[model samples]
Target: IELNAFVAYQREREAISDSAPARQLFNWCREAGLNARGLEHALLLRDRIGAVCRRLGLPWVEAEPAGNPEPVLRALTRGFFGQVSIFSSGLRG
Candidate 1:
């Protein structure tokens, strides 16, 4: 569980909030029995992801201006946040 958490946290910190790495981290947390209610850590992880993406010029579909945005990043963020919300809620319950 510790290893998983560490990996997840690291991935989240290094990638975009909705990137594959961030999603993987959240998945790890869920599989490791970390409660969604304890998702302050996860939220921090997401924040890190968002920062990294911003630095890397990744476009956030929901937040970015309309244009020829990075489709991969947009999709990833949508899926990532959606999964996070769903799994996080499951943990809460």
Candidate 2:
């Protein structure tokens, strides 16, 4: 299983608790002498898919801003706290 926690907002605001373990993992990797600074990436939907969705006349229905900040900060301050979001899209392939 892959455990990734982060803050995200799209159709609606989806805030994730800080998964500092992941951060620590990155730090650990660096300490372990692994060159992984540029190993992670992200694709903003609006930047990439928004135009297509709009041009295709798709019903881009989405909710307003909403997310859990308390948990997010808690996870960041701590190490093992955060939320998990599953990636179900095959779009990145």
Best by lDDT: 1
Predicted candidate 2, C-alpha RMSD: 14.7
> Model 2: per-residue lDDT, tens digit, 20-88?
545664655466454333333323434456678878888664322344355545645565432221232
1-93, model 1: which lDDT tens digit per residue? 233454454555466455475466557657767653466565686689899999999974453443334754676799999999999999988
- Please report, as a residue range, the 10-residue window in candidate 2 with the lowest summed lDDT: 5-14
Q: TM-score: which candidate is best?
A: 1
| lDDT of candidates 1 onward, in order | 0.63, 0.41
Q: In candidate 2, which residue ranges exceed 4 Å CA deviation? A: 1-45, 63-65, 68-93
Model 1 TM-score, 2 decimals: 0.28
Residue pairs clashing, model 1 = 17-49
lDDT of 1 at 65: 43
Q: Which pairs clash in model 2?
A: 17-72
